[model samples]
Target chain A: MGIKQLAKLLADEAPECIKEVPLKSLQGRKIAIDASMSIYQFMIAVRQGGSNNPAAMLTNADGEPTSHVQGFFTRTIRYMSEGIKPVYVFDGKPPNIKSGELVKRREKREKAEKELAAAKEAGNIEEQDKQAKRLVRAGTKENNDCKKLLELMGIPVVNAPCEAEAEASALCKNGEVWAVGTEDMDALTFGCPVLLRKMTFAKSGKENIQQMNYKKAIEGLNLTHDQFVDLCILLGCDYCDSIKGIGPKKALAFIREYGCIEKILENLDRKKFTVPDDWVPNEKKAKEAEEKEEAEYDTDEEKEKTGKPKSDADEEDTEEEVVPIYVKARKLFNEHEVITNLDLKWKECQVEALTKYLVDEMGFNPDRVKSNIEKLQKAQKANTKPQSRMDSFFKPLPSKAGAKKPAKATVGSKRKANDTKGKKGAFFKKR
Target chain B: MFEARLTQGKIFKQLIEALKDLVQDANIDCSEDELSIQAMDSSHVSLVQVNLQAGGFDHFRCDRTISLGFNSTNMSKILKCAGNDDVITLKAEDTADALTLMFESPGQDRIADFELKLMDIDAEPLGIPDTEYQCTIRMPSGEFQRIIRDLQVLGDTCVISCTKEGVRFSVSGDLGTGNVLLRNNAAEKEEDQVIIEMEEPVELTFALRYLNFFTKATSLGGSVILSMSPEVPVVVEYPIEEFGHIKYYLAPKIDDDA
Candidate 1:
């Protein structure tokens, strides 16, 4: 079947799981986008319309940031208007297993970029020249402007420690988001319970939209979540390359019959199965490694207790653990007793400090400062009743003209009444 | 659906050349059994029509009828590319907006796809005149090509005069007049130069560029025939194998000095 037909079938099979929600609700819901994937799709589509630089990075005459800025603002605003709040996650250090793919992609892009630069410098002024520029700009802008636009929209962007999509899938698994949105089918294997396939253009068409229920998907394959993980591992994941001669269907069958990784490995014929040299079972070896690691840890702790110099490895480790002083200070301030007592962690430290310093150093009453902090924090948290609070806080002291005078006007008589019995004194007070 | 045939590649080649020169508004028609195209120059005084028959292609085989809807400008662009001596195939793919042309030669094969765009060229209302006081001249394609080539050296205007005895092509400019004459069947006459004349004489002036373009059609045929009335349009026709003919119409120049 074609991609469209497959998409239709998937959509039909998974209706309730893929039911459309108001874009507003999707706001604050984490979306895991395959950065390179989405940008490439956009580039291809735009080029089909014969744009001069369909992927061209745009710049003003002065050569400031151009193409990416426009794409980011325009596309993000479009998404926002459609009620899909977007958080653009950018890729960082790729895992070692993907190094080969990264090298190939880098070489290809470098060649393209060099050609584009030459075209620009030559002043060709042809349509193809414009197209080359567009392609280059599209790539550069994909990284820079897309991130900035998300920030401007008040969306939370995460620079993943590794593959952004994988991190995003983890976010969904941890209930930090409603679903993980990406075009890659591999995201399901990454353990996202709700994998939204066409989140980017879902609003535009019902045809391409596909939603997979991770639970249902796993059930359909007749494998538990762990078995599914093993299936992907057997099929080759970034954590370990796929075992040769094993594909998705075969891997599923292997996992289903064996029930565990150890059993599957045991059942495999030794001659037929050649494990990759780097295919270390880090998770399986974790317990025994921890015990051996703990024994080494004791020697380090002993070195810390005594005044002896730490081993070279230990010193290297401490150097790694050294925290920047500003971070330390921020942590201290966050846990400060005064800040904690008043529940003002969410307030700006500058604002809180100014109010406290004014009250303490300028002889402002403690009660008044406390009340003001409460009112300010409340107003900041929820934007209601600010005017009333302002009026009350700034109201003038009672005027002398409106003060009531003492009824008897005799200090000696007051002293005699104070000396009288408690019952008579209480009655006088009531009267 | 329409089809037409040509024996030598020259007819098709010259037709393409002429179409390239004419503005796209000159609607040319083609059919399976016959092909005809007629158009007038800017002055509307001359009308040219080119016709070809199916039997001209007896050595080859083509039976399908196809009609092409094209803007003349675009059609010219599509036809400008012709491989020498290769049988060109033109077909419209089932209701598609495009037409495909294929050219085949040893180790060299090419297919050009052109989208057929519709044009709105109104047919000229002026009919071919039935003037009796006229002249007809037959001459070798090379002789006409040579005179046009020489006149182009002077400038972009030339005069043609035909009489019972001979035909004269002359161009004059700041440099001086350049003239060429072909008398009936002289001793130096080659088999290629055949001159024909009528009882009366006819003379007319035309733009060098139009004549230059008109002669290009001769590349597809051996010779061209000139039919004229003094102030009327000139009809240049090419006779190919069997009774097939391709014609072109060009208006006469209005004499400002007169």
Candidate 2:
């Protein structure tokens, strides 16, 4: 959903921005994973699994189905075994701007479910199998169950204020964690210093994860991070619609020709792009200056849809929600509330407790659980220095970055990393 | 009009917790004597019936008969709101579309209320005729549940065989096979793994998932009764005190090779 044509564009324009590294090389790295995204990828794994019936998702004696539990358990353990410490960050209250996107996704899901049911009723196995993959969803119970299971496994789970990707990027930028592991291109738009894609590693080998080095990306594109975000929005982002005819190639050309988003929109032929009626360059500031309490983009449609009368709280809500789409998305990316400055520490694996939870509560096979636990226990017993703590874990990584990473990342970025010294110290302080 | 109250909320909590796995929405028939619900699972591979006599409730009144259709999942959620010691009262009118559940602490200090919107589910109670079985096994519900759970990891279906030797559960798949045999003893107050009475030795294979769902009711009693007839559905029952009971009927898995 994050500028669909962006990856292809990057492949063509900036090949140096992406690198396929061995999954094992990420060993001893403190990674903040997008929990919902990982859960979703695993759900699809079970849904489209060959031969195995999706309806036969693993469940307890009470018929409480848990599709996410099996996949997450295996993946988290896989990450841990590979010496990658996973700190899962879950999404919090969605930004009001994203509410429209969420509604559209929900409608699509409902329609897919209806179609799947109809296909099944018609005794069309092929169509049913195709629609089966479309109707999969990780519901609330599944999410809560995942949190509980991951907590019981002794991994740190953080609840972010708005978006998991943004929180993860903020942490990466602050040098609290090593990188953000997600399949989302939006993580790049959020300016994650390092974005990890193809994270479904346990199943797919070799290309465990593709690291998108943001510094290298910006250097190749010859644009600042802000400009990249504006370009992403112009191409198309989840928060708002893009100009009808504009795409990744055209958007890049526009950014290269014009200085920023404002200039391009100002110079565009209105008949082709169809910019929103009220939209203009820096429209937020203009609207606010015209009238102190004026809504920048009116919340009239949203209010009418919700059938709510105007109140003090409602007015403030509208005021916050009515900002220019790109401005709102950018602000959310910059000011996302995440758990940084907390003790980002890893505790030794409590194998016995993990084994007990898996066997007794989850109904996992005792021998299989024990075997996996044994592997982790053995690793913990032989724990080396570089892999032990969060701060010291990345000492060996910077040199690797110097060799193959961005040429600009060598000297000037050192001082930029040096600027995060106080923030890093705050993050590593023992709780 | 109908109003039923239970001083011990744990019983009501356990009842719904047991039925949740077997049925989605069930019509609870409240009459002059008892409350009963009989419904099949969506796949029709298993049927569950829950019975709670009027005598089991601390206070019960039914001016007229009513069928209250409630989703078991929502019912489980509401039961979670009540403390095990809290008294629970269910209030509903014959014509109303919603049922109110009131939970009051034993000291009457705190009370909470929830309204459950009822559905007019077009499901009629299934009429099950009593069947005399060739083999009947009475064993600790915990033991039976454990065996089913353990063997479940190995295969999708398990064969339950009751011969002169004992009661055996066997499952085999890509992971290899597992056989757990529970023999019987008559005179001992605490029998071995099971107590078996066989008019004729019988063996039947059934979907392990259905058997696992049946075990959700194991907490209702000390022991589970499995009455099986060759080529017929197995009847598994867990009896509650005061004539209340939860019963499951699971169709045997037809072996195509045989």
TM-score of chain B of each: 0.76, 0.94
> Native contacts recovered by candidate 1, as a share?
0.00
Candidate 1 lDDT tens digits, A1-431: 00112223334433323433334334223355556555554544433223443343333454443333433434554444432434555666654435444465567667777766676677544644544533442344456555544443344566666566666666666665557667765566556687776555534533344556777666556567666656555655433344677655566668779985557766877578665433423322345458667322232233244332211223222232222211221221122111001111111214455344434433445675465545434333221111111111122222222121122211112211111121211110110
i-RMS for every candidate (Å) is: 53.6, 31.0
**Chain A vs. true chain A, TM-score per candidate?**
0.49, 0.79
- Candidate 2 chain B least-lDDT 10 residues: B120-129
Q: TM-score for all predictions?
A: 0.34, 0.51
Model 2 scores a C-alpha lDDT of: 0.72
Mark the regions of model 2 whose C-alpha exceeds 4 Å error after superposition: A47-55, A202-204, A277-322, A387-431, B1-258
Give the best candidate by lDDT.
Answer: 2
Docking class of 2: incorrect
Best by TM-score: 2
